[model samples]
Target: MKRIITVESVTEGHPDKLADLISDSVLDECLAQDKRSRVACEVMLTKGKVLIAGEITTTAKVNYIEVAKATIREVGYETEDIDFECRIHTQSPDIKHGVDNPLEIRNKENTIEKDIYDMLGAGDQGIVYGYAVNETQNLMPLCVNMANAITERLTFWRKNKTVKGLMPDGKSQVSLSYDGDQLSGIVSIIVSTQHIAETDLNELREQIKSRLINDVFPEYDLSRTEILINTAGSFICGGFDADTGLTGRKTQVDTYGGIARFGGGAFSGKDPSKVDRSGAYMARYIARQVVTKGFAAACEIAISYAIGKAQPTALDVVVFGECKLSVAQIKQYIIENFDLRPAAIIATLDLYNQKYKPTAAGGHFGRPGFFWET
Candidate 1:
């Protein structure tokens, strides 16, 4: 039996991504000055306006409007933003107090480092999932890997001027076919791009086919590949001008692209103290470690937490029965080896010092040099 699945990715200039970048840039600004900053910044962008609305508590003095426009400019948006608003304020104290003192635990007995793991509650209450598979070298599904590669290359071409008339606002999607999990072939390549108004569409399509599809989609057989360029006609109406953008809107693109379960949390604009970002990253690290150690061909981990508590409320591991070790034994090994507390996760992944702007754009899990990916 055969199955087909697809995954998608967008460029940094995509509206939602632009919003995410602005939000993360604000977070970066705060973390740069005050490592203990508590932030929940959200950004919205449209036509000639940018609105930054959220809560932030930090000793750092940041210029919110400037931070936002600078982020848009970095993404290659050259529009004149004559109207901007900053509705940011210090984070809610109730939440802060909870995070500062959360220390709930199970059985009241533990061996993990207490200094970092004790008395720290999850920044918020939620479930977060981590997944790893041997389908690709990076433990990511092949279609997602290909989709990201295509979009990333498109951005590189736009920025480097290697591809004529390309703009930063773009997206890529790939359809992959599988025969009982064994790779079969590629079904299609879809590219939507924002480009110069005066460029020739026919010529543009040919250029993209020759440069991007040929270069990036060689991993699978393309003997019957159907390349679709700008299916909705010209994409000159893009960026904030075409739509409004908000932070945390691209979580699917941010993670495994539906190949794995997401815990209904977004990563951007939250400090490492927040389990949404730190916990998710830590979960990825754990999943990858299990796969790298040959404990499983694939692993999926679920972690749940309560507000103002340092200990996980629950831990669930599913290894698809591909391992010799029992799930219970594997769970015990993880308990003894790794720390899931917010502070411990922060320290282990070096989450606070990350250059979040890069992460805001690319798919977060598969990238190398990232502590989670390691």
Candidate 2:
């Protein structure tokens, strides 16, 4: 029984990705100045305008407009052609009270700060999903891995002048055929890239098919695969002007790309204190470990949290009938082996002292340099 699966990735200059870029740039700046910064930022972009609106609590003194402009410029957007509007608000003190100090009890038995675990709580009530598979070397679905690799290459080419006339905006999709548990072959590939008007697109297509696509998949024979590039001609108008964008709009692109269920939230622009980001990373970490330990060939795990709770409210682990251990046993192993608390997740992942800009553009999962991938 042969089945097909598809996954996709978009470049940094894609409209929504541009929004994510600006949001995470702010996140990175805040983390650089204060690791404890709590940010829940959302960005919107349209023709000639950038709107930044969100709650942020940080000691960092930042030039918000400059940060947005720098991020836009880095993504190949002509920053001088745009106007910026910012409506940032300080984080609500009520929420900060719980997130910063947590619930404390006095003198029950000399409640000391040394036992911080007792007071730590999740930043918000939400659910996060983590998934892993043995299909690829990186324990990622083959289609997603290939799709991201294709677009990452496009970015490299554009930035280094390897692909002349190639603009930063682009998207890639890879569809893989599967027979039972094994991947069969590539079914199709599609790449739509923005470009300057004068470039010969026909020459660009040949270059990509011969070099960009073929070079990325040395192990796979895709010479006869169905491929398409820029179905619409003259991609001169792209980025925010072509389409309006909002932060968190690319949730599926950020995660598994329709391969697995989402926890119904996005990751960028939020600090590690936001369980929407930290919990998802922790869940992925645990899921990957299950496969690495030889307990399963694939795993999908869910971690749920309730407001003002230090620990996970519930956990669901599915091994996809490929594991020797039962679900309960796997759950037990995770409980005994890992700390699912919000604070513990942050410390274990080192997310606070990290950069998020890279993650804002490319798909978050199935990528290197992220702790969740390891």
Candidate 3:
């Protein structure tokens, strides 16, 4: 079967990504001061203002307004007339009780012996999925990897002034042609970038082709790929000045880029205690290990948890095509070799100690330094 698969990515300066960055920044600050902080911060950004609102149980004493402004400045929006508003409160005691003592322990129904690792419970109940493919070196779908690379290049050029007149906000979309199940080649590439008023469209297009694309994808043969640069003609106005941004708006970009399913739980702004974040990372770790160990060419793992429960309610492993080991065997392997509990995942991945602001913009999966990627 011949088909086309497309994936898109946005630069860190994009409105939604900016909001995500701010939220993750707050999360990072909380974790830095107190390793046991519980943060679930959210942000909304629009013209001349940034609002921070969420439930947090941290003794970090962060100046929310100052942090938001500093993030805006670092993102190259110093000239904007942005003001900060904060409405933060501590986490509810109802949720805190569930998190502190799991349902099993509270009910006295725990079948197995309890330990310190089993004391902490899931912050909430939800399903999370993790996926990986062999098409790219990072075990990610090819189009998404390409799209992310293009947006990353745009950010690099804007910051380094490699391409004159480049601005922070930009987007990239890549389409790949597939013959049956195998990738044939790149079908097309689209780039929309913000620039200064003095920049010429013709020159910008030429520079994008000769410098940006060429530098980023030198190995790929793109002679026949339909390259579209700034299809809307101009993007002079961008960021909060032109549009509104809210946290968790770019969930697809944060994970598998539509190559697989997400459980509708956002990753940023939450601590590892939240099963939505920790379980997802653990799922990805399991899926990646399955593919890397040759059990499957592509893998997706789904783990579902119950609020106030320290154990997962369900576990499923889906693989594309044939597998060397039976699905039941693989499940058993995971049980014996890995621990899927929320607290154990946090320890295994070292989630509390990691800086999450970097994961806010770029696609979280397939990135090398993250422990889950290992």
Tell me, by TM-score, which candidate is best: 3
Candidate 1 stretches greater than 4 Å from native: 105-116
Error of 1 at 224 (Å): 1.3
Query: Which lDDT values do the candidates have, in the order given?
Result: 0.85, 0.85, 0.89
lDDT of 3 by residue, 309-370 (tens): 88899999888866888888888988898888888999999998899999998888999899
* lDDT, candidate 2, 1-374, per-residue tens: 78999998998889899888889999999989988888888999999999998999889998888999998887888877788999999988878766655543222246444456546667888999998888778887778888889888999999999989988788999999889877788989999898898889899888988899888888888876899888786788888888999999988888888888778788889998888988998888998999888789899999998766677889998886478788888999999999888888887888777779888977777778887777
Cα-based TM-score, every candidate: 0.95, 0.95, 0.97
Q: How high is the lDDT of residue 209 in model 1?
A: 90
Runs in model 3 lying further than 4 Å from the true structure: 109-113
Q: Residue by residue across 40-157, what tens digits does model 1's lDDT show?
A: 8998888888889998999999998989878878888875744898998877788877887565533244655445466667889999989888878999877888899988988998
Best by lDDT: 3
> What overall lDDT, based on C-alpha atoms, would model 1 receive against the true structure?
0.85
* Quality of model 2 by C-alpha lDDT: 0.85
Please give the TM-score that candidate 1 achieves against the real structure.
0.95
Clashing residue pairs in candidate 2 (N, C-alpha, C atoms within 3 angstroms) = none
Between candidates 2 and 3, the one scoring higher on TM-score is 3
